[model samples]
Target: MPIVLYHFPLSPPCRTALCTAKALGLDVTIKIVNLLAKEHLNEDYVKMNPEHTIPSLDDNGLIIWHSHAIATYLVSKYGKDDSLYPVDPAKRVVVDQRLYFDATTLFPRLRATTFPLMFLGKTDVEPDKKAAIYEALGILEKYLEPTGWVAGDHVTVADIACAVTTATLQAMGVVLDAYPKIREWLERCNSTIPHFEEANKEALKDVAELIKSKVTHNVYAP
Candidate 1:
């Protein structure tokens, strides 16, 4: 049986899993979990993923959720080589660090600033949240100072993970002009990463539209 991936296209984490699967040439059946409709909160999905997050993978009987874990497992079990996620201790530590950075720092900052606007009909970002996002971006800029990719010279799963969030922010009108290295690295990843457009760009359009639709309606509108 082909792996079943429960996902919503506009989600950056979902795109991370999709991009990793494509890079590893794994056959996956995508089942869209519509967050707008709260399908992910349904009992069946909750049973499969207690956390009820999108991009959970069911490979035969085994199940794995969390985008980074899914990506690492796919690379470890199915990759022809460890190039995307090196097995070497020194190299793998760096990759792990980048993944944690995406999950804990970068993505959370983006979510904090945007989720209220996207989901709660907020019209503006708070000063602190905006500062948090820029602080995270600055750290990413420093990380990319030494190499073109987030983890290193080569495009790893870390690049896929971080770039999806970066692209999402870009779609949401966050400027990258100040972070020239990040801009350049994102350009490189877009050009070289397999299925980059399919996995990220089209879905990002949907995210932009969703956010616009939500925020356009004022809470006090008649």
Candidate 2:
């Protein structure tokens, strides 16, 4: 059986897997799960990934769930560029650490702040989530300036994982104005990487539209 990637465009973890797959130039099939339809909650999907998550990877019938696990598995199995998932022990550890932070720390806070607004279509209480979101962005900004990427001097699974969350935050009206370094880093990541733009496309339109609407309202406010 060929490798199949179960995913959703809006899901950060799913996008992480997608980005990694693309970066490796792997010709894996993508099965786009519909988050809006709650298709992922179906029993079949649940069986594949008991968690019923967006990014359950089927690798020649060996199923793997979780973005971090999928990423490592892909690199270990198929990555041509050692740069994608470096061989150095220390650099590998850094990638692992960043992935851990992305899965636990960065994603949770970002989702808490933005998911309620974007997925649920609720504009209320945005101000309540703003502080936490800003803090998260500030942390990313600080981290980007001192390092070449989240894991080291090269793009790794860490950058791919975090990029999903970063893209989502940008989509949900999280301002980047305060995080100049992060903005610059994002540019570098998208420009330098072949598949970063593909991974980012879904969120880009929504993000730009959201920002434009907000800015227009503010500009015309009495």
Specify the highest-TM-score model's number: 1
Cα lDDT, all candidates: 0.86, 0.76
**How well is each residue in 1-222 modelled by candidate 2, as lDDT tens digits?**
778999877677887888888888888888988876889999899887888877899988899998889988899989776787878897888788888888888888766744554566555444545676667667777668777577777778888888778876776556677777777778877887778887678556765575454343321111
Q: Global CA lDDT of candidate 2, please?
A: 0.76
In model 1, the clashing pairs are: none
| Cα error, candidate 2, residue 14 (Å) | 0.9
Candidate 1: where is the Cα deviation over 4 Å?
A: 215-222
Reference-based TM-score of each model: 0.94, 0.87
Give lDDT tens digits, candidate 1, residues 1-222: 999999998788999999999988888999999886899999999998999988899999899999999999999999999999999999999999999999999899888867687678788767777777777889989989997788877989999999998888877767777899999988888889877766787888887776666654322111
Worst 10 residues of 2 by lDDT: 213-222
Using lDDT as the measure, which candidate wins?
Answer: 1
